[model samples]
Target: MVIRDTHSLQLVWSSRISEDSTFGLRWTHSIHRSLVEEKYRIHDGQIILTEMSFHDYGIGMENELAPGEKLDIQDGQFHIRNMNRHFPALHLFIGQVRAGHTLLFSGTEIPLGSLHAPGAAITIQVEKRSILNEIGGY
Candidate 1:
């Protein structure tokens, strides 16, 4: 749920923004999420939250992030806004949120920071909701 914008990996959610849409015309593909992930599996319609951490020089590195600050979820063609929407949102547990979109390299760090750049270690809090629509499970 918690991921970085990851320029190397671009997951886009295709949606048509109305010219008069509340979200606005400039927002159709204008959405740029710090987190973009796809192809996830839920166990019995549930997600597990676990504590993640990191240590450098045998010491832990820590950073703080607020809710909906820098996170995004994107399917191959669907981008969830800042950990909001029906999708999952990952809360930062021990990392900092870069004000700008982070570029992750192949050697990016996963725990203590990306091999390429600083990465995100999150405290996952999963909530179960109706993933299906009243009309039908799209």
Candidate 2:
């Protein structure tokens, strides 16, 4: 995943560990630079990133989705809202996500993820926002 806003930016690489687990590396650019490595697990329908290591930046952080928090991953499309201490707010939209393919609707047709299976690889591009609170109204 690559998140780029006017105030912050992030680059992420993730690998599936199991049916509901993943390991990731994220680099954030803001007032300073930060490199974070983390593990994520799905619990009660929410994905939580834990066991994180933040290098270069002077803060420790974690990212998660609460149990009731929802992701609109229905009908092969989705809007992803991400918040983290290491970077600015981000919003991502995928036109399709399923086994063997992933498509982004933000006008970039860059192919990401494995062509052979689901969860093999994933990539996301965060749309930049002009205002901090304007989220494109998913």
Candidate 3:
């Protein structure tokens, strides 16, 4: 098998959000580019990226995906909140998850996993602050 050379691109920034735009998370490096790759586990959170993936604006631009583009999940905003019952996932992002008013994360996938898995399983958790803490209440 030919191995692809993925540049060591650190996670410059990261964030999370819900379908209703309830809560979210953002990573700001004290030093620009302080992020690292293969260390996606944040706040003791780790998710295996499924073969799920999709381009931006999956609603209107659903047609953009080619015949074998290989899109596992979606924008995540609508997905994580209200799982696409239509398409169930096998891999998941296990973490402090929530639907709207909690501090938890559904199963999150890495870029690689998100690039392949068809479906995923997510676990939820409780949090004191709204997802707004990570993001600006959006």
Cα lDDT, all candidates: 0.27, 0.33, 0.26
Q: How accurate is candidate 1 locally (lDDT)?
A: 0.27
Candidate 1 or 2, higher TM-score?
Answer: 2
> Which order, best to worst by lDDT?
2, 1, 3
Q: How are the candidates ranked when ordered by TM-score, highest leading?
A: 2, 1, 3
| Count: clashes, candidate 1 | 13
What are the per-residue Cα lDDT tens digits for candidate 2 across 1-138?
232322233333222223343334333423334433343444333445443444343333323454543333433323233322232222332213322123322333323332222333233332333433353332
TM-score, one value per model? 0.18, 0.29, 0.14
The residue-by-residue lDDT of candidate 3 on 1-138, one tens digit each, is 001112332222234522222222222122232211111122222222212222233332234333333434433421222122221212233222221111223443233223222222332222234556446464
Model 2 residue pairs with clashes: none
Q: After superposing candidate 3, which stretches have Cα over 4 Å from the reference?
A: 1-21, 29-124, 127-138
Please report the TM-score between candidate 3 and the true structure: 0.14
How many times do residue backbones clash in model 2? Answer: 0
